[model samples]
Target: MTTYVINLDLPGAVQSRHLYGHFAEHLGRCIYGGFWVGEDSDIPNERGIRSDVVEALRALNIPNLRWPGGCFADEYHWKDGIGPREQRPRMVNTHWGNVEENNHFGTHEFMDLVELLGTDAYVNGNVGSGTVREMSEWVEYLTRDGDSPMVRLRKENGREQPWKVPYWGIGNEAWGCGGNMTAQAYADLARQYATFLRDHGDNKLYRIAAGANVDDFGWTEALMKSVGCVGCNSSGVASPYQAISLHYYTMSAEWENKGKATVFTDDEYYATMANAWHINTLLKRHTTIMDHYDPCKTIGLVLDEWGTWWQVEEGTNPGFLYQQNTMRDALVASVHFDIFGKYADRLFMANIAQTVNVLQAMILTDPDTGALVLTPTYHVFEMNTAHHDAHVLDVVAKDAPVSRKIGDKKLPALSASASTKDNSALISLSNLDLDHARTITLDLRGREVTGVTARILTAPDVRDHNTPDAPDAVAPREWTEISRVDGGLQVELPAHSYVTVSLDLA
Candidate 1:
């Protein structure tokens, strides 16, 4: 096979902090059992939130977390989830499953979870089911420090002071579940709702308007221009919405016929990857529209919710939306990190659908068994965390082919890139072809490498996955040097694999 190489000499711009953000919704087992399981559970936890899960997230160096809902955000009422847990009303989760939401993991629990993760909180407000007063009061309840009813209520409920929450989503998927309003109508509603969200002294809440879904640049353009009109006036202060949110889910199967999580034909796997690669286009097209309106990159594009959506496992509740993470999922995660790293400038914040037990969740929970297992995607994130906040070095590899029934798609068996932090260089590479392993040669170009360590996440087969009994089926393995050529290093990458090469520069 032809070897692909990344010349670290020609590196792109450094990465932005937004690339490290994550999303956590109330869907499936993501919030309740995965992250917050009530203090009564036998599992290791802190105030209902899982301690191990929090530690795992903390280890990923998670930057920010968007919360409340996906479709749930639309119908979510902030009041029902605050104050005391017992007094907090129980509502049906009309979005995810018809399961009852007992208000156990409310605003306090969420903000507290973010605190434990050592990340900033991005709360998605209810523009669909809530009013201006309700949304604004939520801000006061969590952010206001002065003497006020909201603050007093907050203290009486337990939290004496306020938590500084900066990013606030005015709505979520407003074009759909948020209200199903036209761009013009949603823009007007956003104006009214945003007007009431007070900054509350020290906390500068970036009121992010619920933005476009996928290629709907019209929504972004209209909202940005209309909101820019509102923001430009009144002393020409910066816009109330510091960002605009967008959501996209890449699915290989149709809505009803979503493909299997692990058992997939080679054709299905390639098509799935093709769908994931479309993210590059989504970012480019959305950013182009935003650039036309705000050239200086004033407003950010928040892919608040994104990940692979597959059919629910057999015998599992359809509303649960849980699927096993396979090696293919790991490859998808790695490629996503590469795409987001490239677009770090325009992409402000994002969360990978969810953190656990939901669609493409990093952690899965079995409440019955009291078992918690990290998914393959979780290991991919952990491995690639080195790319966080590091410079994006330009990587170029000649296209390699992965043949499928449709046609010969450019597989690029060897995909590689470099990121530098301090004096260390982290090189991430992937071998895309499932059946063919490739020997990749890296031209270090004269950069002295004092030592090298390799970590790989792969499986004996592309379809290999982890169950509760086989959680470590596809985990990262420590590797030694394959070979050091005269001026470069040659590494053998397995078929359908993800690898991270760490170099300690002298």
Candidate 2:
């Protein structure tokens, strides 16, 4: 039996809603067929943006969206994506598939999508292949008001009023595709570029410097030393960039053989879970370095890119990064969110890589039939949406069962996190054991619970997933096997399950 003692009186930092944010890059079908079907296409759409995808994502209460590239951002020239769609230049997407990119879904299209979804924008600018003036003008073009050169260009391109861009990324992976620069070299360039990313009108940009790849603590240290804090301002905030980013993807196997998304053995599953658990360590180590420099914790850490990276579906474009999402993916997401909730103070925002029809996508779209299927990972996001911006509740698990063993390490069978908001609290738990169900006791403290409702996301097999023909193969269903206990509540968590319990506290 696993017992979780949640202290209701002791609430921690408000989990930033942005932590549930998503990423949309110009990769594979994520952009073209997934989100955009063109205004004239047969698919039901609003001004060229697919309405189904919009409606589906809106259900997640998506807070923000990062756009226009992973490696493509560094190479993408903003000018080519503006003006008339017909006249917009056609360029080869050198990084992704070497496919020709007809500049149809550019700045205007993206902002329109943002408007439709009612989400904030996190735009990554070009720093590797683009000039300072180009990056500055792109920011000015989207956000600047009144009559400036960039503003006039924006108006000429059919948008008279300026758009609100709250978050802006300096570059993507500076240590890799964004430019093979050393940490110090990238840090110097970040400072210079950040200087020109001005706050025009009432819009103040939250500039995010492209941070480390995975465990490159030296890169994080360099950015902190060079650009994190130059001097304190009147308000005591002293970072050139408001936040720094980190990108880490969970691969069940090695880079060359990133195990199949839907097919894997128990050993592979345990290995993947172990890899997912490693992010907690990475966060702790990075936070230690960050705490040393800005003891005040003014600057934020944006885990802008993260998710499972499996091999491309066979016969699909390898560069497209298309893969199926399954019960395993949902557990991975649950684990990540649990960790994200723990580090809410320093980790302000996180965007899962490629929201639709790409790596660990929420929704998969069929190119031939125009069919859309929500992935298992999508349900986890919907179930845990209550934690967005809610106060974190301290949950201590005692005598948690060991799920399995990976090498010498004994992996825990359960993962849990709690948060409170308004007059209610949410408890999310994941049972990683593959064979047996575990009974859990919720030892609620400091508050009187009036009512409880629960939902569980699980499938008979961990490999179960949704296809266009069967969209609900692995979806959430009402979980009613919960009973009132002396102190709190008791739940029967089935194997390979993700459960969320909502409590009405008085």
Off by over 4 Å in 1: 1-11, 227-237, 398-412
The candidate scoring highest on TM-score is 2
C-alpha lDDT (0 to 100) for residue 284 of candidate 2: 95
Per-residue lDDT of 1-506 in model 1, one digit per residue for the tens?
A: 44445555555666766666777888878887788878888888998888988888887788888888778988888878887788889999888879899887888888888888888888888888888899899999999997999999999889998998998888888888778889999888887888889989889888888889888989988888885543334566676577888888867766677798877898888877777777888899888888777776777888888788888988888998888888888888788777887777778777788788888888888868868888888888788777877877766554554343433334334456678777788888888788888777776753678788898889989888777899899889996645787666788888898989898876
Could you give candidate 2's per-residue lDDT for residues 139-235 as a string of tens digits? 8999988999999999998999999999999999999999999999999999899999999899999999999989999999998987444445455
On the 0 to 100 scale, the lDDT of residue 302 in model 1 is: 81
- Native-vs-model 2 lDDT? 0.92
Off by over 4 Å in 2: 228-237, 400-403, 408-410
RMSD, one per candidate, in order: 2.6, 1.4
